[model samples]
Structures are given as C-alpha cells and as structure tokens.
Target: MSILAALTPAPTTNETEWSVGDLAAALRRTLEDAFGHVRLRGEISGYRGQHGSGHAYFSLKDGTARIDAVVWKGTFNRLRQKPKEGLEVVATGRITTFAGKSSYQIVIESLEPAGIGAWMALLEERKRVLAAEGLFAPEAKRPIPYLPGVVGIVTSPTGAVIRDILHRLEDRFPRHVLVWPVRVQGEGAAEEVAAAIRGFNALTPGGPIPRPDLLIVARGGGSIEDLWAFNEEVVVRAAFAGTIPLISAVGHETDTTLIDHVSDRRAPTPTGAAEMAVPVRTDLMAQVDDLARRQGGAILRKLERERTDLRALLRAMPDADAFLAAKRQRLDLAEARLRPALAGNAGAYRARFGQVIERLSRHPPALALARARARLAAIDHRPRTAMVHGLARRADAVAALGRLLGSLGYRAVLARGYALVRDEDGLPLRGVAGLAPGQRLRVEFADGTATVRTEDGGPLAGTEPAPRTPRRAPRRAAKPADPAGAGTGEAAGEAAAGDPARGRRAAKAEGAPEDTPAARQGSLF
Candidate 1:
C-alpha cells in the first residue's frame, strides 16, 4: 500500500509488526525520498506563522486536494512574494513528514506568484506602498550626470545587455565602465541586483577603483516575469537610496518597472542608458570648435569697429598746432588793444576820482561832525548845571513845604498846649451842647490820649474844660473885600468876631513885612 512496503521484502516473516512510531518514521523517509524537492502550484490557504520558530505553516489547495506546507523563516524571509492567504503561487521545497502528527508537508525553500495576474497584483501593491512613502515623487528624482568619467552598470554579465551598453558607450564617448555582474531575473535575482547597486554606492571615492559618477541598472527587454527582478522593492529602494545618479533601463520602452519610477532617469534600452550617461565625443568637439570660431569672429569684428572709430575720431580732430596758433593770435590782438584802452580808462577814472574828491571836500562830513561835536560839548555843561540848580531849588522848596505842613498839623496845635476832645464815637466834639453829663470823653494830646467822663463841669480833673463861647447869630450880608488896604481892616474885624483861630492867623500874617513890588512878583512866579 506504500512505497516503503513495496520496496521491502514483504517485511520478512521474522520481522515483528512495525510499531506506530517506527512505521511513521519509515513513512517519513519514504515520502521524502519519493517526492523530494517538488514544485507545487496552488492557492494559499490557512496560512499561519511557525510561532517564533523561524518557519511558516500553511495549506496549499487546488479545488479538492490540499497539502500542508512549511517554509523556514530563513527561506520565508528571502522569498520575494511572502505567503498570503488566497494567493496562487508556486512553492518549491522538499516533502517532509511530521512524525508527531503523522502528517506529510512540503518544506518550502522558495516561493513565487503562480501566474502573471498574481505577479501584477503583487507588483501593484508594492508600487502603492512605496508610492505612499513619497519615493516616486518627481522631486525625489536626481539629475543624471551629463558626462561621467566612470559609469557603474548592474546587469547579467553574460547577457547581451552588458555588451550592448558597452558598445553604445564606445560609439558615443568612451568611459571607464565598471560592470557589477548580477542575476537580472530568476530566484535570488532581486537580492543580487539590490546588493550590486548598494555595493557600487558603498565604494570609497578616489580609491584604487574610482567611484562611479553615474550608475546604470540595465537588463535586456523581456516579459514581466523575466523583468520582475527590477520591480522588486529591494532593487527599487536601492536605486532610490543610492547617492550616485542612476538611470534604469529595464525591458522594452513600453515595459515599465518600479525602478524606472524611482531611478533618476529611465532609458528605453541598455544602450539608451549609455547614451544618457555620456555625450557623443565628435559632437562635443564640433561644439567647442564652433564656439571658438564664433568668439574669434566676434573679437575680430570688435577690433575692426574700434579701428574704424579711431580713424573717424582722427579725421574729426583739428590740427593741434593750428588750433593753438589761432588762440595765440586772438590773445596777441586782445593784448595789443588792451594797453591803450587800459591807459585811457585809468586816466578817465583818475579825472572822475578828482571830481568826486572835490565834491566830497566841499561838503565833508568829518568837518560837519567836528562842528557838531564842539557845539554838543559847549551845551552839555549848560544842561547839567541847570539840572543841578533846579534840583537844589526843588529840594529847598520841598523842605519849606514840609516845615509849613508840620506847623499846620494837628499835632503842632497839640504841642502848643491845645487838646483835641472827642466823644465815645471817636468824633471831635465841635460843641459841648450835644454832650450828656455821664457820657465818656477822650482828650488827645500831642503825645497820647486819656479817657474821662463828661460831667456838668466838663471832664474830670485831668481833663481841661472846653471854652464856652456863645453861639454866633447868622451873619448879615457883609461887603465884599476892597481891592485897597482900607477894606482889609474891616474884613479882619469881622473875621475875628466870627472865628478867633482865623483872626490869630490873619494878625500873625499882617504883623510880617508888607511885600514890595519885586517880592510880590517873585511870589507870583
């Protein structure tokens, strides 16, 4: 019923019936030997991890038949398309048995998408993931070197791709190309291509082998499967991360890869990449020659124009000697006329100056000023003398007026033994008729005042009684004063009768000398 049993000699009669463990062990060996390193194409299902054991457990199913598969972590990690449920893929591994469970399973060493559709789906998913990371943005793209001294290329060394690039570079501008041989397709191709790109980048500048200024990851045109290595995330990221400018020439112009989008530039073919790296030698030479000729022609034209301008300037300029001679002649003629004209002007000026001097001498301001000075000096003392005399006279008159005022003052009358009497209201009593017997009174002397009580007998002992004079009757109409001295006597008698103080003043004035005509005139003034 089994390969092990069929291969044995009927298990030999002496052989005891195999134990369950032994049978399982024998069966595992038989299964492994018969189906070792088999390839299976199926849709993945029930995929699970090896649970930290660095392995994966899954079931590969095609309709009814299904097989359990296990891929070790090492193999699983290396797989370009990792195992996922519902994905159709081709799994290549050895068939092995799990004795504990008594089950047969394929130990997958490698895995790939089963068809173009699966591959495309995986490719699109990868593209989206990397695109979200901004890896494929136009701004991320670097500019390819216009001319590289050394060009690094990553592709299959045996393929026509490498030859084509080399030949293209030779046809254009020959360059030192470093070829990093790598598998462009098949298993492990992605890793090789990615590693090659990184290896080229890791090279030290100015080393034994000069670091490439530009890089080219190229492969001949092929189907998507044949070209899928270039689309790998590892390859695309390597190209994107490389410092050197990279040009990706993968497959035909119509066939696109992830590297094409990530690389600095994309070429339709490997030859195109070579062309992008360097320009044609002959074309560059021709350009340099053309530029040199153009520059020379420009210089010659400029020099010729400058020469013609110099000649025109020379023609326009007058002869220096003739110009100087004409100026000299004008100077001589001006000088010849200037002598006599200056003499005539000087003589005329002298005559006019003499006339001005004569007129000035006739009405000399200095002489007039001297006369005015003498007159001012003569009058200056007169006004000063007059001011002094007038001041002295004014002072004398002020002193006389002060003495007169003092004699007329009330204090002067009090000093002459006269006392002023006032009632309680501070008013001088003109008569004793208004006084009451007990009313208070104040008597003012020249020095001070005393308070006293009014009585029928007048004030107290310290006070003096007021003179009792009968009240005067109303005066009859009196004759106007006569102009002569005769009427003065009658007027004086009448005044004395009315007011004794006025009569005393008039008698004192009359006792003085009569004024003469000159004295009267002086007093009038």
Candidate 2:
C-alpha cells in the first residue's frame, strides 16, 4: 500500500449529519441525569414572569459566572414574601441543558432568601409601611402585666420552639398556656397569623371564648423567609390592633422582624417570650420569706431597746431617804479630809488660851497706877519742893532745847524783834540780781510789818519777776529735853515772837537763792 493509502480511510458518498440542537439536547439529558438534585446560590437578575401560571424566570450570576433559574407555580405558591430586585437567594434545583434552544437553565424546586442584606430590605420596607399606620408606636403596643393569669401562644405546635417555651415557662413560671397553632410560612401564612390574633381578640369579655391576659406569637429558627410571615403587613397590623398584649418571638437570637418592633414586647426566641410572660414561683417564695424576717427583726430590736432603757431608769431612781443620807455622808467626807490638821493642834489651842488669860490678869494698867501712887506718897511733903524741883529741871531742859532748836532753824531768830525783807509783793528779794533799787517791798516781822525799797538794776529791772525763795521753816515748837519741861521752854517763847526780817537779810547775802521761778498771778505785783 502507498503511504497515503495506509493513513487515509475510504470516503462514503452519503452520511447523516446531526444539527446543533440535536447535539445540545443529547448533552442536556446527560446533565439532567447527573445533577437533577443540585442547588445553586447567586444574585437574581433579568427576572421575567409568566402571566397567570405564577412561573418566574431569572438568571443567577456572579462576577465572572452565570446560570439561568426558574421557579414554577408550585414553588411560587409556597413563598410567603415575594422577591425583589437585587435580592440574594438560594435556588435548589438541577442544572440541565436545553438542547433545542442550545441553552442551560436551572430547574429550581424551592427558593429562599440568602443573606442579611435581603432580609434587612424586607424588614425596612415592612417597618416603613407599618410605622405610618402606628403599628410600631408606643400607643399601639399594649403593656404586659407583671404576672399574667393566662397566656395565649401562636406558634407551630410540633416544633422545638413550642416545647422549649413550654418547658421554660413551667420550670421558671407555672402560668397556663393555650396554644393557637398555625402555619408559620408559605402562601396564606400572613392571613393565618392575622386570623389567629383576631380570634384571640374576639374571645375577650362578652363573647363565647375565654380571654387571655397576654398573647405570645412565636416560632423556631430558619432563613429570613421562614420568619417573613411575622414581617408581613397583615401580621404587624393585627399585632398592633389586637386587644391583648402580644409578644413576638421569631427566628434565632440575631433575627428581627416588623412584628417584633410593633408588638408589646420582643423576645430573641420563643423560650425567651415564655420566660417574660410570668414570674418564677421559687423567687416569689424567697421574697415572701425575706419580708417576714425583716419585719420580725425590726419589731424584736425595738422591744429589746425599750427593755434596756426601762431597766436603766429603775436603777437610776432616788428613794425618799436619799436626801437626808446624802447630806450626812457629805458632812462625814468633809471631816475626814480635815481630821489630820485638827488632831495635831487640839491640845495646843487649849493651852495657849489659858496663858493669855493669866497674862491679862497680872499685867493690868490699874495695878501699875497703884504702885506709882505709893511711890509718890513716900516722897517728902513740901509744896515748894515739887514746884522748884519741877521748875529747875524744866529750866535746864528748856535751855538745852533752845540751843538745839536754834541750830535746827532760824525761825526763833526771826521771832526776836526782826522783820523779813521782800519785794513789793510778799515775795522775798533774796539777791541783787533780781532786785530794783526803787521797788518797794514789805518787811514782815513777828510783831509788825514794814515796807522796804528794792535796789534798782538787776534781772528784776529788765524782765519779769524772779522766783520766790522758800524759807519754809515749820512753826512747830521743838521738843524739850525732859518730858516735864516742854511747856516752859525758851524755844516756845521764841516761836511765839514771829519776827522774820533778820532771817531774810542773812539769807540774801548768802549767794543767789536756789528757788523755783514764781508762777504768774492773776493780780498785778
């Protein structure tokens, strides 16, 4: 065989050719078989709807990837809340290629909202509409009583949410719970919730049903759409307008709904709502005990203090005899303090008083006088003898006294027919320094008064008057040498003379007189 014939096959005249559509269809069937139960998660875009059948078609996309998605009437019927633009969702379906159209589409069985972004958008829209009608207002939310009599529960009867709440309520609080079971999701869920709430309201007084003190609308955890029934406008309006207080407990701890904001109270979960509904029995018992103890302790302490005060008053009281006894005790205590000094001086005081009486009796002045009279009677009896004796002795004493007094003062000399010279006033002109020759002065004598002239030209001529000399001799007579001679003395005779001029002249020649300047007189000199 040639080299070309060995490598190449014989060509046929006519052969069947498959179209692009046919090829795609075959591949699509294989894909459906492989991934029919698969799920896809992405942001929906370019959404389209079939008119009457409730079918929706949209594309799921990422930054660099895309997938076609569709939700048929059955799945759409179960959606409690409709989807919107820019919503993130998870579509559970199989990826299958359409061979006839040469395109792939996701056969979605169910759909759910994806993230907090979409959930928050639904929440905000619900809030805006419900808030305008006063659903989230303080006036619309009814206050929950601290201890409720009966609580109405609107939740799934078979869910863990209901079991947890029941267990918690009975464990912590034992209030009665009446269940109002309802579908918490899918189509018509919002209306079911509203109907249940309205039913509770109708059961109030003057009706054929029992009225509950409070209502708790609760559910278990899921995605946002699972809790979307509580976020519905129907549920929000019913919660606000209901007569009883409503508490919304939906989803997990992190989830929030429009019902939560509008209801009287919101709990993180259904169990939390039950816990809030009633008070714990154990705690109430403890409170009662504590109050009883406090009241008892306060009363006991008051009684104890009163008892102690009464006892102290009784001990501090005074009896009738206390006054007399107190005075006697005080006298005894005083004597005890003074007893040492009194005991040592008692004998001495008696003896000293006796000696004083004896002395007074023996040394009486009358006794001395009697003795003196006896001595005089013993003397010679002569009248002249007594007088001569007395006179002679008096004369001797008078002579001595005269000499002594003369040395002591010059008053006696002035008294002996002498006058004291002075200026025109009675002031003595003691020196030529102050004397004027034509100035007339008085000479004072013991017997008479004479006027004398002052020598002119000295301090007295040019200036005011000079100070007076103070002779200052006392006029008292000197004491006699003997006691019997005093009245008969020559010194007494000279003192009676009163002459002063001789004394004045003698003093004038003896230098300048040391005298104080005279004081100015009101009368002229």
Please, what is the TM-score per model? 0.57, 0.46
Candidate 2 runs further than 4 Å off = 1-10, 13-25, 48-54, 97-100, 171-173, 182-195, 202-209, 220-229, 251-254, 268-271, 280-525
TM-score of 2: 0.46
Off by over 4 Å in 1: 1-34, 96-102, 319-325, 328-525
What tens-digit string does per-residue lDDT give for candidate 2 at 290-379? 999999999999999999999999788876588579898999999997887687688688889989888979888789999899988877
Give per-residue CA lDDT, model 1, range 1-525, as digits (tens): 698778887444665798999899899888988888988999999976555888788899998899898887778777877888899999898998898787888888888898899999998999999999999999988877778989999988897899999998999999998999998889889999999999999999999988999999988888888888888888888888889999999998899999999999989988888888899999999999999999999999999999999999998999999779989999999999999999999999999999999998998989999999999988987998999999987776566445435544556555645577777888766555556788887877778988888656334557664433433323323444332332244444444565766444333233322222222212211
| Candidate 2 global lDDT | 0.72
User: At residue 284, what lDDT does model 2 achieve?
Assistant: 82
Error of 1 at 459 (Å): 36
Root-mean-square deviation (CA) per prediction: 14.2, 20.6
